[model samples]
Target: MLDLHNHTTRCKHATGTMSEYVDTALSQGVSVYGFACHAPMDYDTGFRMSFDELQDYFHDIETLQERYSGRCTIRKGLEVDYLPKHLDSRVLDADVDYLIGSVHFLDDWGFDNPQFISEYMRQDMSQCWQRYLHAIRDMAKSGLFQIVGHFDLLKIFNNPPDDSVHEAITQTLESIKSAGMALEINSAGLRKPIGEIYPSKQILRKAFALGIPITFGSDAHAVQQVGFGRESAQRLAKEVGYTKMLDFHNRSPIVCRIP
Candidate 1:
């Protein structure tokens, strides 16, 4: 199985070494594991590692890649926030197996963060979803990423988006398809207040009908969290009629049959 979106201590908030995470993945029988630590950006300095730490991050992943060569496949990746003006080429052009583009902010406000969740009650919920999906559309159009991380993460706090945002979701998924990007079925949402997988069953059904390729990630932040909810994620994918899932090697998707 493949679990491609995980973080390390470099992300500031996540705990554990890269090796510890791999050990957990191995214990869970994951054949292909990846570390997509939060990419450094000037906007969120507190949560992500500084630009200078990029070297060490790469070195650590490379070390794990060699150390786990035969036992399990290790992929190097970066989870980049799709902030238009703040995105740097150093990260966009980083040499890694893949990049997971995500939208965690609407302007300066991190809509997903509980600290500013009250803002949701203040604004038009549909407008907020539209703005977030528009960012996803632009991120896909940029051709800078291989996977879309946590689609519908705006609902992390259980702030449901109204049907008014239907067209936006359709357009965003179309953009992802046009970009040849795969959507990650992130299980982390199950651990969050939303208590559902990323993209939701509704969105996943739409993506399936649109022929967008699928991938899986636990979005693990701690060692014990590695490969967490993997079985449920696989079950969800199958329920949505997905028989194969995408992994990556050198930023190119490698399709594997779901077992």
Candidate 2:
């Protein structure tokens, strides 16, 4: 099992240190690990690892990399917010071994502020989805972030979205396949408002038929969730006909078997 989207104390909301996360992953018997802290965005982002503290973060991960060399392979990653206006240039591209492009904030008004979710809840669900999918398109076209994180997270705030909305989502994901970007099966949703995997079974099945690649991430804020339910996700991936996930090093994909 491998998780590429996890946060540390550096990211205001998360609490685990790099080593602690690695240690937990070790106990869980996961052979591959990734440290994907939240990256900067155009808006007033709330959760971020200070640019000043970046060296220490890298040093810590590097130290673990050396110490756990024979135990588990570690990958440096970033979960970049897919801000449409700034999508052409993002930190996920300049740094990090891998990127998980995510659409967390859809508008220019509310950022990581508390009012964001509340305001999002009040907005029209269809309009919300429109912006979300547009952001996804930008992320896929960016040529960065091989992994597409939570492709349909808008549904989390409002479940049982209308049929027209589902059709719109499918259209966007089909473009994801044509763009050659991989999909992330985020397991964190099981604990969130949606209470299921992001990009539900229907989306996964559609990706299967469209020939999009599949990847897995726990998006674990705490070490306890690192690579959570990875076995089950792998089973689902196989059931959907994805035998392997992509690993991009030096900006190239190296196929890794899921089973």
TM-score of every prediction relative to native: 0.98, 0.89
Best by lDDT: 1
Summarize candidate 2's per-residue lDDT along 1-259 as a digit string, tens digits.
Answer: 6666678787788876788888888887777788878765545445776556666776777788899999988887777777756543436545567778888776664322445676765677777677677778877776666788878776664453567677777878877887788888888877776677877888899888888887778888887878777777777787777888876665456788876
Residue 239 in candidate 1, Cα distance off native in Å: 0.7
lDDT of each: 0.92, 0.74
Model 1 lDDT on a 0 to 1 scale: 0.92
For model 1 the local lDDT of residue 44 reads 75
Instruction: Find the 10 residues in a row with the least total lDDT in model 2.
Output: 106-115
Candidate 1: residue 258 lDDT (0-100): 85
By how many angstroms RMSD does model 2 differ from the true structure? 2.4
TM-score of 2: 0.89
User: How many steric clashes does model 2 contain?
Assistant: 0
lDDT of 1 at 150: 96
